[model samples]
Target: MKTTLATIALLVLVLGWTSEAIQVQENGLSFSLEAVKRLQEMFESRGTVQQNPRSRSSSSSMCEDPMLPQELLPLCKQRGASASLARLAMVPMDVCEICAFAACTGC
Candidate 1:
């Protein structure tokens, strides 16, 4: 069991370190190398990935008429997003806003 786990870990490390871009798919799910690295860093730092000030995405840069859920408001604020654009709408625009928010903020 230990050996199996170790081998799996090694495989992941190898795949992740092989190049700047890592793409893998299994069981109909895909994973990104950048996301894997970020997760590993998050774990190593006890859930504290050093936040880069420049990486923070401002709300102004996000889509017009942002529609983030109330729960994500605090997280958005932490990531340097302004709440001025917040609104209550459920439309294609809201879906785009959610996707853009998740991608931009890495949530």
Candidate 2:
């Protein structure tokens, strides 16, 4: 039946996308860790004290911004690792999404 075939096709597409997401996550973890390592290296090279710049009043304000991921927010609060760095680390995954979208669009 057409419906059954369509259902099977959808299932196949779902499985494929899921696998792609898993692969992205695996790759993303390594990429994020490397980013953190590089940031640490840069800080050490600078010989500057690692202290978060945000004051108590600004801390709550920054938390409201959804541009930063919830999981990385805590790390961003730390002295060396910043929200910008965390955002930078996520760039690859964002690119992957764009590439995936382009592929889906037959571009």
Candidate 3:
């Protein structure tokens, strides 16, 4: 109970201390609506850049690397869609795997 109360008191004190840093001064709001609207407007103003046929053909569909293992080719297909899986496929190595390979060499 005492520890919980101390934690709460510390949290309150830290929050109070950083209130100014986290809040907007003009209207006492955390975020400025104008800035958000401007960012939205900027994206809207720029519009979409249409890809040429050549660029479209060169996109993520070419994720299959000839150097990569055949089993990993399927995982590479979803590289853009799944970051963690893509990372795993790209770096499919570990200390244990290296040790096993070294043992197999009989050196």
Which one is best on lDDT? 2
Over the stretch 1-107, how does candidate 1's per-residue lDDT look in tens digits? Answer: 99999999999997767543433222223334343333333323432223322232433333222433333334334433433222111112233324343222212
Clashing pairs in 2: none
**What order do you get sorting by lDDT, best first?**
2, 1, 3
> lDDT per model, in order?
0.35, 0.41, 0.32
True-structure lDDT of candidate 2: 0.41
The residue pairs found clashing in candidate 1 are none
Candidate 3 colliding pairs: none
* TM-score, per-candidate, Cα-based: 0.23, 0.26, 0.22
Give one clash count per candidate, in the order shown: 0, 0, 0
RMSD for each of the candidates:
15.3, 11.5, 21.2
Candidate 3 lDDT over residue span 1-107, tens digit each = 99999999999998766542321111111222222233223223333112222232332333432433343344444424233222222221242133242211111
- The candidate that wins on TM-score is 2
